[model samples]
Target: MNHFTICASKNDTHDIEEGILDTLAQGFVVEKNDSSYLLKSKGLFKRHQGAIHVIADNTDPDYFAKNMPGMMSFYHNIPFEDEQLKELVMIQISVFNTVIAVEMDKEITDEQMQLLIKLLSSIGGVGFLPDGTLLDQQGLVIVYPNGESGPSNFRPHACTKMINVQEATSAQGEARKNNTIAFLVEKGIPYVASLPQLPSVEDCAFKRQEDIAKRAVALLIAIQFACDVAQSGNIEDSREFFLNMLHKYNVQQFLTDNEKSFLQAQYPDAQYPDAQEAVSIAWQYEAYWTLIWALGFVETLEFPDDVCDCDYAIQVVSSCETFEQFYAQIAMRSKEEILDEADKIYRLHWACVNSRINGQAAPLALNESVVMERRRALFWMIGYRNEQWDTMSMDT
Candidate 1:
């Protein structure tokens, strides 16, 4: 059986019916594929296929492009009754799924994008729960370093298997004593398992990147909501709402610098750039940023500061056709491999340049503009992941 069921509460059933009708009005038609569900949205540029799945007892369009390895997004259109819950559900789903977002007509700032990367990176490998808690593969609750203590706290209930005792023989011995399966656990501070035999404290970096992308998408959705509210003549209220949202939802603390910039841009006397111009730039630029961030393999691999020069970064990322392709090539595969398979290839491609720094060989000669063009290609790749490439490339 699927993890989620289609049945809803009596009150929600009515909303679901209305949502289905509205979706049909917008050209969505549901059809079953094998044992899965498909909702096809036929438009001029491309026919969007939404793979419907009910996860965590919520239904979403588990999105995929014509060709891609990992799942990209989970979409849902909300009815007016519970829009906030719908929004929260989508955000939580995206966070757990590890989606990478590209640019579109949506207005999302580069500053906001950076914050998303930070938020996801903080989660390490495991994605956050809806309320910002961490969970393991078996649905066991792990400790949240920054989370609040709750009356309905499930952590203690789920951590029945955890064994923590002071005055243990050895540090490694204490870590091994836990009867639970987790990469990391906390005694006083966090303790990471040793290789296959021990529990670990840190999350995997590549997984962290996925969380970053998901949070970015959530931020964009929030920006869209704020813009809609602003359009309704509640500009001050909207702005305040957005401010509060960043404070509450941004668990990774990614918004401090971006929030400051956003407010500065909004002030009457502030040198606010053109809103239209900023929106246009943010949509495409954010996608480009995601691609470059992807190249770092987030938690998996770490690059030296000098390696991030725009030209070199573009060269490293553009060599692959898809994000999955890029990750496959550059990632490292070992017992405790941090990098993805694709990232390893890019590392090898740039081996000579890195060798010079490591005192082995001279750097390769590469063009600046050529590298930037490749970076642009990565933006295009991310668009494909979002199924937005059809805006220019195909017609349904």
Candidate 2:
């Protein structure tokens, strides 16, 4: 049963909600039997008990505003407050338009027009609930204007994706489009798209921008660590340095401030709370930051010309079991290149993160003394300090 459920069919509830969470939350990449990466959210696609009663499209500007109150009441068993439900609706509306909406050529209703707005805003993070699959091609349900019956979404490739929004009496077309967008917006949930370099992950342009932000946050945290320690004159463990900086500068706070300025200066159409939530998650994702850095996944930190051998991967980075193994992937470059990377804390900071998150530098986990000694060997392969790290751009 869902940990939060009180349903009598407790087994059914568990089979639904947890199944979705277990599959989609946090991790995005899943290795296939073929050793390839599946960037799709497999969990959302998993078979489950929860049901989404796809409702009819509505056109009233008040359609979503109206029905949401009903859904809010109906899904009481789902345990979301009205405001939270409203926020989800807003996020969904802002992400994709009339998700799973069908195309109908009819007089455009206020609702259909409203739906077009949502579809245009939909990006990588939008998807159907429970099994977050594609709602529709480009994740939209097209409602064409009346007297234009078979246009099929009005877009270039929507021909194959076309489906009539609702069967109208050559008359009720407008009502249907509004109802459709409003319906999907009400029921649809926010979905964070899976990882990169996979067909399942759409909106490559947006994802690229997001990945840049994630990497920059990681580097910023590391730099803050060194800068903080240098200022206070402490040479303790990098863990202490990390905590101190988090406390002193409150990384989350600064990120919120910067993000606000960014949104205001650029992305005039973008929403705020959503942007804030994303950065907030990245702020605490120290492990990911470290992983991207050591593995050279973040382009900004990549050595100018194979300067650091961190490019090779023996196994999927996420599955690696040892910190030393992660360190070994990136052998040091020349003396100048090595210094280009940064100082002792630079190496030490990552080492500690790898060890703490995956037990890389620790001896206790190995049990075998030889294995422990071997880890110590790999840990030191990439020398201390890398000035090269500081040169990367963080403009995203």
Q: Give lDDT tens digits, candidate 2, residues 258-315.
A: 4333322322233222333334332323323333444444444421111223223213
Candidate whose TM-score is highest:
1
- In candidate 2, stretches whose alpha carbon ends up further than 4 angstroms from where it belongs are 1-96, 99-218, 222-282, 290-396
Tens-digit per-residue lDDT, 13-65, candidate 1? 22333433344334546564443345555555544444433222123323322
TM-score, cand. 1 vs. native: 0.21
Best by lDDT: 1
Clashes of each: 29, 34
Each prediction's whole-model lDDT (CA)? 0.32, 0.28
